[model samples]
Target: MDQSCDRTRNSLSQSPTPPLVGVETGPASEFTGKYMVLLRDGEMKEGLQAIKRVASLTSVCVAADYEGAAVRMDEAGKAEVFVLDKLGVAVVSADPPQLRRLQSAAAEGGAILAVEPERIMYAIEPARDRLAILDYLRGYRDAVNRLYDSLTGVPGEAEKELAALTAFTDNAEFTWGVQATRVNQSRFSGRGVRVAVLDTGFDLDHPDFVGRPVVSHSFVHVQTIEDVHDHGTHCIGTALGAQQLAGGVRRYGCAFGGDIYVGKVLSNQGSGADSAILAGINWAITNSCRVISMSLGARVQPGGAFSSIYENVAQRALTSNPGALIIAAAGNDSNRPIVIAPVSRPANCPSILAVAALDSNLGIARFSNGGINPNGGGVDVAGQGVSVFSSVPDSFPAWDQPGGPGRPWPPRYHTISGTSMATPHVAGIAAMWLEARGAGTTAQGLWQLLTGSAVRLLLPSRDVGAGLVQGPV
Candidate 1:
């Protein structure tokens, strides 16, 4: 396998240069004024030189010179070009005429591969009312557990005794999500695999993950890997939480044995830009992580085209040796029985896996986006999302408090819904499959096993591409 950045060096060698479309602009297309530039593999120096010449760029900032990919964007923003060396990509701030010059260079088969406007993205926010339904489900579940305990044994002892019987049942020992995916029955624990979760930073002090191996870095300018927002902590909990949990907390994660990689691409306010996301992807690939789970994306219009730069990067990741499979959330923009939105960006790229959300009854989530558009915008798989139980920062407020209680414990756990919650389930299960399939499996091979082995549902393929993803037996 070629180790150089020019994984697609042959893209221009044997063919005529494709017609250039330059940068797109309009009211519907929301982008930062800056542009993203893809450099041909192995021609980074030439690309930089071309950019300097075409755009008359005077200042440049290269990521290779920084520590932990923490390039000071404040300083970088002042430069005419900011280069992500590992990914062979750059963010350029230039005038429209200068951008046209770069496009002309690309059309002439120069080192510049592609140019597009940088996009704005966010951590997929669940529908405003989705959490209300999740809260109701949690209440019903607790009532059932309380009734079952009172009718059978001591108030709390039922959970401990029946924990052994939780393999296929949703109870106090295992979340409905764990039972739905059947991860509880799988023997593989994802040992020796590397799983990267890119979102808001994580709660490094969370007690549930006290002893786990974690490598964390932040691409968000000036932000550390510490998850100030609860979203990243919750997502990581579902993908890599401990199996042998203390305090009788139900099992929520899959791939408990996989090495954890945390990439903080989104900010504490649950928003981010394309440059941060691309940098995070580069860092994950550089580390050879086998699974890169992103629960963030920008909303796309019904017929919006996917980013060519992202598509190319994802393809290279799949083809590279010791490659990584990137999974992302389908947007939660639908109203169900009313309106259905297209899948979100980045995930809409053909090479990335788009994940939809499923409720406890194995029904498509009302807010889960679908395949309303063509060209790789379909939802590839479904996972448990409604009323999901997962870890959160200890200081985080519980989603539900007891009705007439004296005072419940400061629950270090939470239950929520969204495609954001669903994506990690697919990612964690992918890690388990990699462990089960053996060291010889490529990223493409893992993708095949995932969709091929999915439990087909009656839902339209648009809503659930191959149906729900399942753990390997």
Candidate 2:
């Protein structure tokens, strides 16, 4: 949803096909030949030892070779061979026969609970032509600025005129989604709630969020927590930006008082593997975040089942303290006028809440993916996505002129359209509901509250699910 399509497009085209359930394959199968073994809670040390023993017998180097291995501390704060102890999962490279032997040993020793093949996942592409629209807006703003500057010879007059124009744009009414969902009328501000947004990353220096408490972590090894790609910043802003900008104008944020947790699952190029996303989820769960919002995913073919590993992880997170509810974008692969795409991976997982995109007119966005899969694998709700206005990094590169100084006119907000944009609206609304429900609320209860409270719109169940998500009264 970052408007950068090169990497994502290639990923989509070359993505590996998922294996069928209970299907037997040879060592030369297209599968990655790598398996993620999930250890039982409180059995990480035993699991590691068992894995090391298997490696020794098989003559394969342990993934956790202390000298030059991929070393990272575990959740227990101990420097371990694998980096996913908190999630109780370990990545091991092995062929079918080797994996079976490892599984047998793990089961016999009570080291691992389950084993699953590591699958490839790509970031969902956003609505097309968004960058062009942004550029047009920037040009219009520059024109307005030049005209204002040329007309006003006196400093005081120029200042007064600029203030008036800023006020006009700032004092605009609530966004259509906010008004349609009646979030503007909600008294609850999601105070004392921690919401984790797993995406590209965030703009550490964005002025609009300057003093807001944000706990951040980077799961993508190549990238830091700094959001060079604007997708994560835009999603985070909609979820937890300040009610008022630095200039005391524009009331855009929904959960103004909610605690923010930024997890960089995707790399700076707006692409990442499933391992990084799984790690981000583990981190969010470890932090006890009440709601985890994911605005990225990979497209799924019709009849494709959800990822069992993600579903299991989400179920575990739901049973954690205060419970963590995952809300994800349904994807932007649909063409309402022609073909309708099914819900994507991660979101297609039944335990996760899949959100679709709605326009200002209460119509389903043409690019919003549909709920083609039956049972629990469709969209659960809708949110505002088209022409959505939210915060972006002050120094975002896309906003800069081709040959001009690095800085284009400084901007605190941007407009984008995608199910990715729609996801945070639901996330923020969920936070408000949590705040109103007070303590001792579970993830399933929050999901019910959200769907039951949604306003029924005149759209297909496949397109809009339970309808548009609403805020607490």
Candidate 3:
């Protein structure tokens, strides 16, 4: 017998195929000729052997080296194989007959868990119109400053303290979501909690995070851990930035003392493959992180079910890590009063908490995704997202752009909108709750406590779920 044949036999003999859950059997319409096969955790070797076996049965060409891994390709580039061992998943492009055979092999081999179509994931933020938004915010800030100056009469240390407090409270950094959740009153600071933020990576040398404990990795092979795009850094800042900036100008973060785990799942372009996101989740679970924050997702049609791979991974992480919770953005694809988009993928997974975005007035953000599914996956909570301020990379050009004609340019501290901003607020708040609740609490229990404590609003459940997520009370 050939060596490859021997390996295939060994792989099939290892274990029996597990039941497929939440996975569609046939090829998806979006992925008519391609599918992704996910293996059980730590079973990459067996999975690869199974894949090779399936390829040998078809007319596919199996190449030993395709970007540091093996690939199976058919002519016309319509069929290809991407073996993502780090994610325990393999992406295969094949015709209907080939896909069915692969699925059959996967089911019999046991090493393959799910065979679903590949999906795209992206950072959940609106296209940057920050320059215009910054100008409007600057005007508002000037007005507030003028009011503050007019109100100050007594000149003393007490007056200065009051001034500082006013400035802090008035800024976008001190968003209404922060005030509404009452995080300021909580004594807990997520001191020992480890939070994994899976996004477009972070600025490793950001001055604000100088002394903080940060561990970072890059799943996007082309990019390093350094964040060229500011999305990841902004989200991390909201979740784990310092309590105060250098001059005590603002109070922007929630879990000030939480350990930061930055996973660059998305590339600098702010888009990523499903395999990369899954790999990031695996990394977070392996690292024993208490909270995994994903401000990224792929839009799915209404009534679409969650991905089995992500759902299973989230369930495992919850059971394995003490109080480990995965929080994700609901996405920024809605146009209220017109079109209302459903919660995005991964976030739509029941095991993951889906967070919506709310403005200062407590209304749902125009772009915040809704709970259209009505079954399992829906918006679980709300957070401040509109005109929200947080830390950004000092080198980001948007920060230096002049606000309109005469208005001052936005500072290193930045403000933006989207469910991307809201997600970290919830992640940081979850960290605070985890800290207050102490140990032995399960992820589901923390989720209940967080949702149960939410300040109910008048918005529909489809829009805000249990309402604004609260901090430790």
Candidate 4:
């Protein structure tokens, strides 16, 4: 390691104060008053010394000090610098003078790659009227199914079969998403592969996952890996739920045999800092999880730039030995036929697969974002998102069910709509592809396998990307 703090000290004596790395553009956006420092590959120790020398920081917490990048959050919260050792990135709390000095070190080109402010991210599902939208889309699907049945001849059994094949809907055996995506027909079960879902955590006590293999940890401060918000449970169910559920209702999951690594990055309130997310990713990559599903993001403006810190991390994760592919939600910030918001941050990064949502009709979801932004901000794939059926925590309260619309009673299973719901479908299918393509498959290979085999829709590439992701035959 470059233990020459004296060199940095000498350079600082002659050089002028450098500008801050990043500025907050919006008043509404929340920052943690900390900055993310991306270190050059294989220079982690050197980078730490440079940062500490430049910033005059005292306390530092390295993930290696703990087990499996699982730094004690309480201790980490008190440190001036917290390093995700495996990821080669640091979350730094610095004063103005210290920040300027650190920027100078980065400019001088020694170990430090880049520096940016850490922003808070949330579960990509919108907070308002989600159930109402699901109800409306369900009604729309039912109407379309009824119309198709009425148009078919009432005499022949073959005509009924054709109608069933053409107009897909949630049946007694499988979810509409599973049927539409052809997951029910795929021979691959994603066996032996590991899938990581980073979100609001998961329900360990959920009966559907009783015998399933699950490895879980929490990165959020003062929180457990247990899911209280219901988002993580839903996403995990879509990705790794069993082929046959406990209640023996509809089968909703795609990868029934893959290992589930649950990282509680977001809090029970459905929000988390960038540092926690990065830590979660580090944990996943360190554990060699082949497919990482992140159904969470921070919304960006029309021309917002993707985070270089996250981009570098994802790119390295893809190209590293036994690499992993990262999949994230494209966001639910748009109103179709009108305003179309750009893809969300982190997901907007080129190295991360950005997934958009599609309804049962194979049309883009009304709230699914588009690839309107420049650079790497584009939707890479589409997945079944609207009115998608999946599992939730058993403790989840019952909503408008029984006499009401199609919501499940007892609340063990629930149907919702978002790009959040769509991401895990793509992730679980990626697991299947990894298993089908062979054990030697890399992240780049998996990416090619997915985009190359996608079903091209009639919509523009910006909206549907390569189109709906398909499973291996």
Task: Residues 1-473, candidate 3: write the lDDT tens digits.
Answer: 00010001011112111110011111222333456787777777777777767765332322223332212222212336555554466667667777777778767758877788766666733233433244335435644664566567435544443433332133535655567678777788888888999988998887778888788777786578788777789899889988766635467788998999998887786776675676566667666678899987776777788888778767766665364799998877676748898788888988899999876656676667888886567989998777666776666653434453221324455556678888999999988888898866778888887799987776799899898888895
Models, CA RMSD each: 12.8, 12.2, 14.0, 12.4
Every model's TM-score = 0.83, 0.76, 0.75, 0.87
Instruction: Mark the regions of model 3 whose C-alpha exceeds 4 Å error after superposition.
Output: 1-34, 40-49, 55-98, 106-111, 124-173, 321-323, 399-410
What is the C-alpha local distance difference test score of candidate 4?
0.80
Worst 10 residues of 3 by lDDT: 1-10
lDDT of 1 by residue, 73-95 (tens): 66776778988887789999989
Q: Candidate 4's residue-wise lDDT over 13-123, tens digit each? A: 221111110001222567889999999999999999988888999799888887777767778878999999888899999989988888888888889888899988877
On residues 92-150, what C-alpha lDDT tens digit does candidate 2 reach at each position? 65666667877787667477667777654544343234332443354356447746675
Q: Worst ten-residue run, lDDT, model 1?
A: 1-10
What is the descending lDDT order?
4, 1, 2, 3
Q: Which 10 consecutive positions of candidate 4 have the poorest summed lDDT? A: 1-10
lDDT of 2 at 261: 92
Candidate 2 at residue 205, lDDT? 84
Q: Comparing 1 and 2 by lDDT, which wins?
A: 1
